[model samples]
Target chain A: MPSGALLFQSVLLGILLGGLYALLASGLTLYFGIMRVVMIAHSAFLILAAYLGWWLHERAGLDPLLAMLGTVPLFFGAGVLLQRVLLTRLRPATLTMMSVLLTFAIALLIEGLLGYAFTGTQRRVQLGYGSASLEVFGARVAVVKLIAFGLAVVALGTLYVLMKRTRFGWALRATIQHRDAARLLGIDTDRVAGYGFGIGLATAAIGGTALSLDTTIYPSLHWHWIGPLMAIIVVGGLGSVPGAAIAAMVLGMAQSLLQIPMGTTWAQTVFYVALFATLAIRPQGFFGGRLAQRF
Target chain B: MPSGSKVLKLAAVALLAVAVLAFPSIAPNPYILSAGVLVVYYAVLATSWNFVGGFTGYISLGHGALAGLGAYSTGILVAKAGLPPFLALAAAGAFVGLLAVPIGLAALRVRGASFVIVSISLVLILLLVFQSWSSVTGGSRGLVVPRPFQLTRPEHHRIFYFLFAGLLALAVLAWWLIDRSRFGLGLKSIREDEDKAEALGTATYAYKLIVFVVSAVFTALAGGLYALWFGDLDPVFQFSILTGSYLVLMALLGGVRQLFGPVVGALIVGIALEFFKVEYGDTPLHLVATGLLLALVVLFMPDGVLPAIADLIKRFGRSDRTSIREVSAAELREQRLQNAGGTK
Candidate 1:
């Protein structure tokens, strides 16, 4: 009973949102896939990037997109250092509990510092193009979304090429598949892990920039992003980047559609129900082949 | 000698109970009394959480949702159904325990990190449900239930504090009983290695379910008490991850594996945070402190403050045994060999 134009608009909006979701989830899935680290700190890193973008935009009048060139490297280095110093020591331990506590602590620290500096008030990156829109099939779509989607596609495409074609990428994949075998073959497993973490964190920059374009940023955004990120990772099949992309789209579409039928508060519940149901049926997830390879 | 140990334990329990019973009267200040009540509440929640999270190694991130279920259920019974307070509390606990069964079945199929993911997802789902179902759950504004007993006098307030203290004491006793019971041993075995436990003919699933349901019951009871104390029930207060963090922090700071660890940890952390709040007003310093403390505790003292203190006590007690027999390297190697053989 929905209008065709409205339905088309919904689909387009969903795709745009999904692109951003995929950008956020890629880092999470990559870290999990390559290093077997859940990286609960991922959302915190994204928030950190968002804050950095906000700071640059406010102070230097720099575009949030331009700020990524600097923040990406900084977060990448931080991620690598974190893995080398803290996570490396906890290897072969259950790591799950410790990781949760560790990442939660980091998140708390970030949120606290942000609150102290910026207060709890929400801020948005006010780009000149933020309010610009394009009319399509009797619906107006924001130009920022289009730009964000374009950037996401470009970034993901480049990442795909790097992951599938590069020598380091092969090593990363090999290590994920069989650590013992990879080590036996003289691959620098530690280096791969470090770089994988770095790359994972760099993706956060892309996601944060995209996010700031659309929504309001606050100290609590880390908490808000974590639930959706976790959902996407689980539904996509942990450790599968392409699977994450597909799942994010599906979830984004589902969420957008649910918003039209059920109110905003209920939209989150629908996604979680779908997540639970999916977990019950396919705990390995939709693209679980990669997961099985590791297990 | 074993009888002496048992007597000592019983004496400790009696003394602790007496001290708790006398605390409200001893500390007449409303702030201190309220803090004491809060400590007991967290202690109960933390101990209940320990049964499944520590003993079974399930790490349920959604326990606050379970507690919320209990609070909301009790509130509805009292306000909508006109049930008596005590009866509503009992019903709430039972209902929440029952609700945990299906979630347990679905979640426990996965091991390790996957379990944590599922638990957290469950929490988010429940929070959304509570927020969205305005007619039933009273929406974001939430329903305010009347106090279980009117606090017309300071004596009445003292009585409620004592009541909560008693409930906390009961929860502690229940946890201690479970800790020493055969079921506890089964749980420990499963935690050490589930495949090994299953190989040894332990019904891992059944024991997990039992521990989870029992934990849920205790958590729900605490929730009921919370509603009674605050005279209000709201989704944000009940189902927040902040509540979940309270349990995690208490368990971690107290010593996850120890019986009285959560009790000590909850009291210490709760008091410390209270002091911070009083000192700093609404500054974010407390969050920073909490984060730093959490990191330090996990990194440096995984056994928690209680266990660390226990170790110190044991070391001091053993310091006089100068002629204690020490294992030779050969003997230790032989022991390792035997262990390996036994495992094989």
Candidate 2:
């Protein structure tokens, strides 16, 4: 119904949205990959980080993008402490069920604290170029979206290299693939899990900073994001970062394309629907057979 | 298993039922009656949730959506079709029950954490659908249900209080019947080991579907009743994940293995939550308190407070006779651990 230019523009916009989604989902996959914990509180952490960005921007006059430089490591340390203090004590036998309850409690705690501090009112980062758009091949792209996409690409690329090229990343991957075997090879898995969880939270900081740049956020807004991020990870295959990234892009494009045909609310159903369809058809996901399910 | 103890237990239950029935008559206060009504509503929701989540060992986070479906179904039928309120309520429950068939089939294929994800996604999808379908659902403006009975506010609250209390009793009765039946044993087997159950000739899928539908139907009934009693239907409150998780929290906190676990859970949580909201006003303190309660319960009383208390009571009393019949819940945990498979 729309022109070729319109469809192209929607696809581009969708890709940008997917990139943002991928940033959030990659952290979830990393946690699940290494810790075998669902980390349902992930969106809550992302929201908290976004609030941090908002606070930094308001008080220190730092850009949200720049705020991540300080907050990411801070969050990483928090995650490590969290793992060491609480999650590490859970029995491996009941981790799958217990973690859901534990993380749910953690999520409620974070949401309540954030609500207590910031109230439920929505807040957004007022950055330069927020309302400006650049024309590219007849499609107008918001500069904020472009920057978010660029940040997502850079973060994801760093994650890819860290997993593939570094010793710690290799240790992390080895632990994920076969924990007992890796332990036999002297991988100090407890330390890896602690750091792995920290890495996941660090990614949340990145995603949160990007989110503040583009959208209005409140303590409760995490509820709206959890479903879509989970869907992306599920569609990508539970622990595969590259698979999740591709799935996020595909979901983003589908949502954008659907928006052309229907309303935006209806378009948002794309990922959840994809999630159900994926579970029904291929529960192992697009990256099935690549890795054994760790739990 | 002693005859005298059985008779004593029956007497205790009978006395409790009589007291509950006489509560409205004795109190005669609108505030107390409303709180009673809220507690009964939660009892019905949490007990119904236990059918799937407890007996069947599927941690469903989408039961709230079932209730929402029921509320909207009743609302639409009464508001748009001009159906009678009571008839619409029954129809709404059945409608939601039928709706769960395909969804349960799709979601129950996956196990453990994936199932939780699917369950949450279903509720979110339903919430979005109800919110966006403004033409039928009235969207964010909300829908009002026509009350069938004409009575004063206090009298209306009293009547609904009785109605919800009766529903809770019925739900408990159904839970008891299911617990004693072959069909329930089939479900417990599925909860224990689906593959083993199937190998041993249990139709695991059918049993799961039946229990899931039954759970959804009762949840829908509570929703429809809530819509009627409250006279307002908003998708956000009706289909909220927070409400869904609260259902899990109550059921888990009360001891899902016990038939009346949800009732005790509902009573404690419902009353505490009400008082907290009243005391704390609009701040996030109530949520913080709820989180603390859930954490404390999960950490200290993993088998639920009822079982833990029963254990303490037995220890203090030093009775050789078993006070409560223990279900094979340990097997359920074993099944989940097996599903978790390799260490991570």
Candidate 3:
């Protein structure tokens, strides 16, 4: 219903948005792939990292990008400790339920602490580049978004190389494909799980920083994150990083295009409807292989 | 001596029932009475949830959506169709039960974690639907249901308290009947091993459907009661994830297999939340506390508080007779054979 130029712009914006979404979902899918943990509290962690970035930027007058240097490692360590201390104790058969409860608890704890510290007020990180835009094919694209997309592509590319080339990456991949067999091969699954959780949390830091630059955030942003993240993971096939990337792009385009005709709220509804339909038709997901193994 | 113990147990139950019935009358304050109403409402919801989750091992996260469906239906009927409050409540329950059929069909085919995921997705989808369909469903602002009875506000609170308490009692009785019935055994068998049960000709799908519908109906009744008590309805309040979590928490905190586990869990958690709210105002600390408690319970007392307490009581009392009944291997095998033969 819209003009060709307008539609093209929307698609471009959607692709840029999708790139960031893919980065966020990549961490979640990768964690699930290796450890069989869904990490329901992932959104909470992402929001927490965003809050941390906002705090450092506002209080210390540090740039948001530099703030991540401190937050990412701290989050990674916390993730490793979480997997080693708490998640490791739960039995494999009951891992899904236990992880759900554990992550839920973590989310609640984070939300409580954040609420206490920051109150429920919304805050945004303001970089000098926040308002800057560039002309691309006659459509204005925000400078921050462009930077974020580039960062996501680079990060994802690094992750891809890490998974395919390095010995640790092979170990991680082997664990994902066959954890028990990998364990039998003396891979030290505990170490792998700890690192996998760290990697997942580290990705959240990247996503949080990028997202805070784009929009206002509050503790309640976790609620908004879970649905879309879940949709991406479901569409991409759980644990498939490439699948997640493609799914994010598709969802982003669908949502943006729908927004033109249906408006924002309806557009959101259509995205979820598509997610639900896709899940119902193929629970294994768009590119899900033999990974149909239960969490 | 065993007969005497049984008599004592029955007497204790009767006294507890009488006390609960007279609570609103004896309590002077409106807040306490309202809390009592909430406890009853939660008891009904949690106990109904146990039918499928506790007994059948389905662990549905979408029960809250079914409850919302019932509440909204009652809201529409009372507000637009000009139906009486009580009739609307019954109709709401029926409607929600019917709605559960297709969702159950699609989801019940999966096992364990997949089932949980499907249930959660169903609730999320329902929430989206409820929020988007504003013209008929009142959108996000929600429809306000008019008070049906003419009484003082405090008196109205008392009336609803007793009404919910009655419903809670009815729900408990229904669960008790189901637990003692052959149907309950069949469900338990399915939970333990669906493939094995199917091999024995248990008709697992049919039984699961029945349990799902029954659970939905009772949960819907609780929702209807909630609508009446709140005198309003909102999509967020009705179909929230918190509602689902509360149901799961209550069921888990109490021994899921026990008839009164959910009731006890609801009461304890409800009282705990009230205490926290009074102490800390409206901070999110109460949710944090619940989350901590849930994690601790799962980690240490996986069987829940009731069973743990029961075990403690048995140990201190040193009563051999109080030990749980155990079936020997041969007897279990014979029962299985009998079940298989009966099915054939």
- Clash pairs, model 2 backbone: none
Every candidate's CA RMSD: 3.9, 3.5, 5.1
Off by over 4 Å in 2: A290-295, B1-5, B192-201, B319-344
Which CAPRI quality tier does the interface of model 1 achieve? acceptable
Tens digit of lDDT per residue, candidate 1, span B10-71?
Answer: 89778977887888878968778778877788888888889887787667767888888888
The prediction achieving the highest DockQ against the true structure is 2
Q: Give the alpha carbon lDDT tens digit for every residue of A1-295 in model 3.
A: 6888888889988999889889989998877786667777888988998898899999998887888899889989998998899888775535666677677768777887888899989898878888999988888889988878887888788889988999999998888888889999999987997898898898888888877778899876686677777778877777788898999898988888888998876677655665566655776778877775332
What is the per-residue lDDT of model 1 for residues A121-223, given as tens digits with 9 covering 90 to 100? Answer: 9999988888999998798899988988987888899888888999988998898888889999999999888888888888888778777777898886686
What shift in Å separates residue B24 of candidate 3 from its native position after superposition?
A: 1.8
Instruction: Name the best candidate (by TM-score).
Output: 2
lDDT by residue (tens digit), candidate 2, B117-171: 8888888898899889899999988998888689999989988988888888889
Q: Name the candidate, 1 or 2, with the larger lDDT value.
A: 2
Error of 1 at A251 (Å): 1.1
* Global lDDT scores for all candidate models: 0.80, 0.85, 0.81
* Model 1 score (lDDT): 0.80
